[model samples]
Target: MLGLCMGLAGVVWAELPAPSFTLAWTHTIEKIRWEEDYRVTPSGLLLGEARIKGSGAGMEIPDGAELREGAWHYQSHLPPLQPLRLGRTPEAGDYQLCIDQRCRPLGDWVGPPQADRPALELWSCETGSGAG
Candidate 1:
């Protein structure tokens, strides 16, 4: 089965079951919620959709975005990413990783960030190593 690999400083720390997942976080300045859906592909990770509850500075809706259910939703036109990097500082707060309608703090999968490793790297995992 496909999975996700979470790493710190070039070392794999943990793995989680993931064919697809939604990453949700709050905007530090606007305090509004933002979510992005990503799918794991053999080539890389593909960003499928994005949505934001309300909007403010640096949160302008995209050209083709539709406002639905009190949120602006849109599809990303960008290509797949080989790996995604996320900040894990107190300032950035915690990110909620959702899969199959359940959610959990990202730190639960990879553990809290240390002073030396304040960022987490995520990528598609095809090999069986560490897959849950």
Candidate 2:
């Protein structure tokens, strides 16, 4: 009986799920043409990597170029979010951001569709809030 109880407890503990992250906020943009700009730090470095994906005109994405090969996939490691700007001023939004332990967007999912792909939008979020 003692062994069975311990085994059951171990199983339950192992089955427990990990905590989730949430998005802080999101920003909608009209377009992202020209050189993709990102935030930079004082030492001139990227804050995080900016991964861009979607289908559009004249967007050539070679096969096996990335984990997902849709109509387009352009990714770059961006500098920290301190000295970043979008054109004349900064363009961004804040939404809660979170991540599932098992799910990876670009790594796990297929690329965007071919036709009727809308203009790209940048989404920013914090961790844990049930937002995507």
Candidate 3:
């Protein structure tokens, strides 16, 4: 009976789901943009593969770029990363992006939120273009 109960418990544990959240960021410099998305769990970790995409002529991932970041802590905490933690996720409605301390509302994205696909286009910024 003990062995049987243990086996059943294992089955139940296997079905438990981990709390999760999705995060996407876009860092635009000059005319180029860098973006990344991660599926994070309660433990503040990437659940699976992360999605990455960018648009530019000659740009590389910055030195501090990371899939798991401190912002996740703020994002998971009771208070979301809103006015305090700008450039992250929004509180409600439409996605957004921040650049040089300025933020703008974004429309629906074009493709899937995947590495190759990516989520919506979110927002855009230009270095002195004044066209954003």
In lDDT terms, which candidate is top? 1
lDDT of 2 at 88: 15
- Model 3, 8-123: lDDT tens per residue? 11121111121222333444333322332322222223323233343245544444445454222111223221111122223223333322334444332221123432222211
Give the lowest summed-lDDT range of ten residues in model 2: 1-10
For model 1 the TM-score comes to 0.90
lDDT of 1 by residue, 1-132 (tens): 677777855577877767999999999889999999999887667999899998799988889999999999999988887678888876677889999978898888776656666888888875465542
The CA-based lDDT of model 2 is what? 0.27
lDDT of 2 at 93: 28
Task: Put down candidate 2 lDDT per residue, 1-132, tens digits, no spaces.
Answer: 000000111121111112222212222443322223333223432333223354245544444445343323345544333222221112332222224423222211223322332222222222143222
Order by lDDT, highest first: 1, 3, 2
**Candidate 2 backbone overlaps, count:** 36
> What is the alpha-carbon lDDT for the whole of candidate 3?
0.27
Model 3: weakest 10-residue lDDT segment is 1-10
